[model samples]
Target chain A: MNNARRNRSFLTDEDGSAATTAGFVIAGGLTFILLAVVLFTDVPIIGPNEGEMAPNLEGQIHTLGAESWTNFELYDEVDGTWDAESNPEAKWFLIQFMDTDCPHCWNEAGPMSDIESNFGDRLTMISVAVSLNIPSHDSDREEVVAFQEKASLMGCNSGNSDCSTRSGEPHDWAYFDDLDVTIMDTWGVQGTPFIVIIKPDGEVAWNQGQNQGQEIMEALVEMLPVVEAA
Target chain B: MILSTTVVLVISGLTILFGALSRTEALRPLFSTLGLGSLVDEPISRRMIAGALGGILGGILSAVWVWVIQRQEIIGSTSLCIPGSGCVAALSQGSSNNLPFTGLEFGLFFILLFSILGWIALTLHLDPKASNALRLLSWGRILSGAGTAVAVWMTIIHLAFVDDSPAICPVCLVLLVANIVTFAQFHLLYTSHSNGSWNDK
Candidate 1:
């Protein structure tokens, strides 16, 4: 009779219901914990807001945002000089973000020569050596020289793998600056071969990674201060 | 490949957890507190990781597609990584690898690496205690999971093709293969469990 009575009491108890409630509470608590981690750090599920203004790029004036493109100060290693800023008449900029060690960039010297020939006075090209881990200045200069020669560039190619034979020569490009990686953090240009052509007004008249040679060249021609005679 | 098995397990686990959280209205408030749904609906919670994988996998797959597009004329990407070629020396691109061949080499490597490693991390993080299997094993459900990966890979290659971009990856195609193997396992498990014939099956 005692055993039977004990069984009856156990069946009537609220432990099962209490356990269910406890599990629900635990799930609830964990949900809050994950949310806490998410709120502070980046979480994919909660994407960054869209239509938000892009962050300002470092090493360039924020006002450049108002225009299609902005100018960067470039220093010539060989001439030990600086490229002049926009010809008040300059209307387009061919901006290239490259790495000194890039093989593709080396190959690009050939096409680049073709591009200069094709566009002539209509384009103002700018190329930046963007690297997070900067090397010695002399080494960087050598790499640039090596890059030109490897690609058989005019004034660059002297038929030698070792660039020591020919001194580094600056292309007709108007600007050359080391990449400000902070600009990558700010504008999020993490990848290399990133290029943008800004108009006289400083708007992104043309932009994409490298390999868009034709498109970039065409955009520059269209944006030039020079107009075709009817 | 057995590498595919692991991807299936993790994705299946995620699907179950997602379904349960969505249905039990109470679960949402807690997830919201954790900031789970700020970027996408709760449905796409794992998509960022998935999207990154898509890019990687797509590059790997593009090897074969690129080989096809280039015809038998050439066996490599236009920009190759030969020491003399300068494709691999710098520039953040994958090796100036030839397609299909590099695809097989790097493809298998990354697939094994990504599939196994990704599965381990996902399993550890996925809330197993919270899953609701009954909510996630429909015919359509499995297909959607596989489709998400396939679509992402195709889109990347499409862009690459249009841009004449180099260094294609086969990440998405391999990931899709991973998803297929994974979903099949889930189907097997769900079927076995539901029939109460798990022991025999």
Candidate 2:
């Protein structure tokens, strides 16, 4: 009976009730604040945000000078070792950092091909295939090689991996395999389909990001005379 | 996914409402299964109700937040973290990551809706003459409780095993902890009641 009486008293305790209510109020308020923050803001408090500088890979990857195009060497399924700087046939280098798996990169290929044909001997476009699948979303070398062949980006034979030399009509452009992303990281390319036009002098003339395929070629067209004048 | 989420939310919301009412006879078995087998004699049904509602609130908030993050991610935006908070990296690559758990959000929204209904039902239960109508409300607790349990489990797994980075949303986790505490309080109330240490009369 005594225990029953005490239990009854506890049940009606306004102090306990008030404390519980207070706790709920505090929790609800905090949850509201969190919801607002997450919903309204961009850039998580923990992750990388936009507006960071694009990496400049001048000396580390390829020196920025006349030798920039001919000296830059990347592996090709056909050519084994393709040299960009030694290609005396081209006057400028239009280097792009792309991933085979990236949809945007695939979409950008048409405009890039147009730029290649239109520029003729004025430019040597090099498509640097960087595989992003390392550590997390890892892509293999085969995938990259296959991407190059299907897209017909130039200088790679997808059907015959062991076959050397440009089997078909050698694409006017060049391709480089950066499966390790050594060049990408050095250039701070966190996204795919990044385009940068380098003059024969090795100076960065223009670079476009995201859905800038048209702008990229246009920029190349605009920079043609600037390169010739130098 | 949306349909399943809705079903879970509606059921959980009903269960939470039922748990809030004073019909211990219907809820006795449930309490026992929830590890609260002590409500036969003494009763702390009010505390249990409070705990259950609290858990629902937290769970709903978490579900909503995750849904929002997914939307931002799709738009090529990052979910903002508190400055210098050192949260883990974004869940995945921005362009490629298709956000998961949209259904969870839908469920949480309905749970919130049901909770409001439950609160109204509780008011009616407090009236002496309206007790019978409120009995139906108690049945909803099973759904609510089960849904809360699932939400809690999913959140824990994401935090524990899925997240490889150190960054975590403290606010989301804190609310989840609050929900867990609510669960504990519910167990405590029922256990105490059965053990003859608590009374709701």
Interface RMSD of each: 17.2, 12.2
TM-score (C-alpha, index-matched) for candidate 1? 0.28
Q: On residues A134-163, what C-alpha lDDT tens digit does candidate 2 reach at each position? A: 333344444444444443333222223222
**DockQ each:** 0.02, 0.03
Stretches of candidate 2 exceeding 4 Å from the true structure: A1-143, A146-216, A219-230, B1-70, B73-80, B83-140, B166-168, B182-199
**Model 1's CAPRI class?**
incorrect
Give the TM-scores of the predictions, in the order they appear. Answer: 0.28, 0.38
lDDT tens digits, residues B92-146, model 2?
2221122244443432443353354334223322321222322323333344454
Worst 10 residues of 2 chain A by lDDT: A73-82
